[model samples]
Structure formats: structure tokens, C-alpha cells
Target: MLSDFLALFFPRFCAACEGALAKGEKVICLQCDYKMAKAGGLTDNNNFVAKKFFGRVHLQYAWAYYLFNKRGRIQRLVHRMKYDQMPEIGEFVGHKLGAALLRQGLQHEFDVVIPIPLHKSKLKKRGYNQSEYFGSGISKALEVPLDAGAVVRTVNTASQTKKSRLARWKNVDSIFDVKDMAHVRDKHILLVDDVITTGSTIEACALSLQHAGAASVSVAAMAAAK
Candidate 1:
């Protein structure tokens, strides 16, 4: 009972709600997890996430696990995951996404899972890529290989926050480069990321993968802004 004694003194809090985590709970409490808004129609070919890239990129599938509301629990969870050095939060959410997709029989649709890469500078600063952790969880659930080194972010563009849609697209356009075509060539790729706003970053990454000869590219994210 030493673990229980330690927990009594140093209780772990839920990442989303900051409530004392109950036994068997990790990262997020069950109540908060249940309350988080889920993106609907994930199995549809023309789902919301897929529609975001219409006329820009051809995605084999596209889905997001949650609807991101400003100041919501998802926002807090993502903030802590990205800025608070808690990458486990991403993996937790991603595993849920992978489980959902697995239930829909979509696990085998992708040959590899590629998290959108961060620039070297940001990677060094963050010490971990949140998306890669997300991809890791998905890989574990879906039984797909996770490849973080196949692609690289060539430019460390400024944050997309507060930027107009057009500006956001321009900022991320052509910023991704495929380092090893063998990993992606003629393979169905599932691109994973934390969030999607204007969809510019995902579009850019998909385009890069397509140019590198990926047979098809799909997208998955932890959340998408409404």
C-alpha cells in the first residue's frame, strides 16, 4: 500500500480537469473524457475533416477524435500536452482514437503512421514531439508502423494562431520535405497531428507525401476546431 500512501500525500490530478485522479484513471478522468465532444461521421468519406482538404489534397480517409472548443477541456489537455511537457496526454487521446477506428475496421487502411514532424529547433526545445507520441499510441492500437523520421519540417514557421486562413496556408506551404521516400513510396500513409485549424499544415504534409510517391495519404488528429 506504499503506492496508495504516496498518492494520498501527492495526489495526481487529471490533466483536463485538474481533479484528483481516481484509481485506474490516467491523464484524464472518466467524467471529463466522457464529456469531451467527439467528432461525428468519422467513417464517412466526406466527413468534416476530409472536406477541409477538398480541392487541395486527395485523402483516402480523414477523421478527428474531438471537436476543439476554445477554453474547453480539450484545449486545456492539448495545452498541457504541448507546453507543459506532458506528452502522455497525446498518447492517451490517440489511443482512444485508434480504438474507435479499430471498431470501425479501419485499422488496416494505412501502411504506416507518420506524425507531422517538428523542426529541429522546436524538437530540441520541446524534447519530444507531441504528435509522434500520438502516433505511437495509434501505432500500438492499429498495429501499424510509426515513422517519425521519414519526413522533416524544413522551416520553423511562426505559430498559425491569429493568422488568417490564406496567411496560414502560405505560411506552411511547401514547408515539409520527405527525407526517405522508401518509407512512404507506394504506401498508404496515415498522417497524425495534434489539431487542425485552417487545415493548411495537414494539406502541406499530405502534398509532400504524395509527391514522394505515397500511394495515398489520410489524416487523423486529436481534435479539430469548429
Candidate 2:
């Protein structure tokens, strides 16, 4: 009751568009909700994200939820979730994305969901892994457990922005280490991330998992940068 009283005077607002949201609303206004582009939840390999990993990661399936561009609403949404302590935004998008996959009968193929790990120092500074927050939402919707510890980032690498494809791959080559190979043995792992640019980070993580005995790997993200 006290919480409700406080809410009456201070209603929550959408993180992306900054509009007043009704009680229990998380983030993104109703109008902005309609603006979101569903990249793919269908069973097809022609999606933009799947094309990026073709012949590279051998994904069982791959897809992203939005086409991200500079100054676009999708970019703004990602920025808020990554830097603004708005985990609800990630969770909200993840749930909708998961539901879409479920409708397409694609959510049952994965045995486990794993988020790309950040270096320990970076996690300490950021207080959270933004990708993990999205994985949690998908895990809840898909009734699968999240393996947040399946992979570990061993080095604090420089940002990939403005870096060439070869440079990014070099930076991520030896930066990931697999943990507890036994747990991931013969499993189809779904690797999650906030975004995919050149995909070096996801590729590195997939390689580490493959070496550790993963049967297959699929990938997902909140958005894909073009």
C-alpha cells in the first residue's frame, strides 16, 4: 500500500523514450513498442544475423531481435540497458524475443543459455553483465537454466569500436577460457550477447566452448549492428 502511494506521485517512466508508464510497466513506451523490429524468430537461415556467422560458427540456428543503427531507437535502448542500470529493458526485450521464438517452435532446441562473460575487472566496475540480464529473461521464458559461469573472460581487452575485423579477432583470440567442460559436454549451448558487430567475441566464445566439448552452439542477441 505504501509503495502504491509513492507510485501515485512518482510514476515510473520508460527508459528508452522517457514517457510516463503505467503501474507495473517496465521500460519502453507503448508507441515505442510498436516501433521495434523483429529480426527473426522464424525457422530460416536468411536472417541478417545468421548470415554473419555463416561458415564461421556453425550455429544450429542464429537470430537477433533488432536492426541497430547509430542514433536509432534500438541503439538508444541498448545504451540505456548497458550504461543506465536499466536491466528491466533487457529483460523485457528478451521475454518478447523468447516468446517469438517459442511461437516459431525454435526455443526447445537449446539445452542451455550462456551469456558472454566480461572480464572480472569490468564486471566489478559495471556491477553487472548486460547480456546476462537478457539471458535471465530468456531462461525464464524458455524454462531452461542459465550457465553464466560456463565461460570466463581472461583478459581486459580494448574496445572493438573503430577496430578492423582482423584486429578485433586478434584482440579476442586468447581472451576466453571455458569452465567445467563436463557440464557443457554434448550440450547445445545458446550464447547470448547484447549486440553483434564483427562477431569476434561470439566467435571466440564459440571456439572455446567447441574445444571444451560442446556438441553445437547457437547465438542470440538483443540487437545486431549493420
Per-residue lDDT of 1-226 in model 2, one digit per residue for the tens?
3224434554388666778886556566777778866566457877778888777778877778877777768888899888876666777787777787777777678899999998999899888898998888788888778999988999888566777878878888889998878768899998999998777888888888998899999888998876
What C-alpha lDDT, on a 0 to 100 scale, does residue 172 get in candidate 1?
A: 83
How far residue 186's Cα lies from its native spot in candidate 2, in Å, is 0.4
- Each candidate structure's TM-score, on Cα atoms with residue i matched to residue i, is 0.92, 0.90
Candidate 1: Cα lDDT at 25: 89
Question: Model 1: per-residue lDDT, tens digit, 1-226?
Answer: 3224434554489989999989898778999989989887676888888898899989988989989888889999899989987787788888889988899998788899999999999999999999998998888889999999999999998676788878778778779999999999999999999998778899999999999999999999999986
Computed on alpha carbons, the lDDT of every model, listed in order, comes to 0.88, 0.81
| Candidate 2 CA-lDDT value | 0.81
**Worst 10-residue stretch by lDDT in candidate 2?**
1-10
> What is the clash tally of candidate 1?
0
> What residue pairs are clashing in model 2?
none
* Per-candidate alpha-carbon RMSD to the true structure: 3.5, 3.2
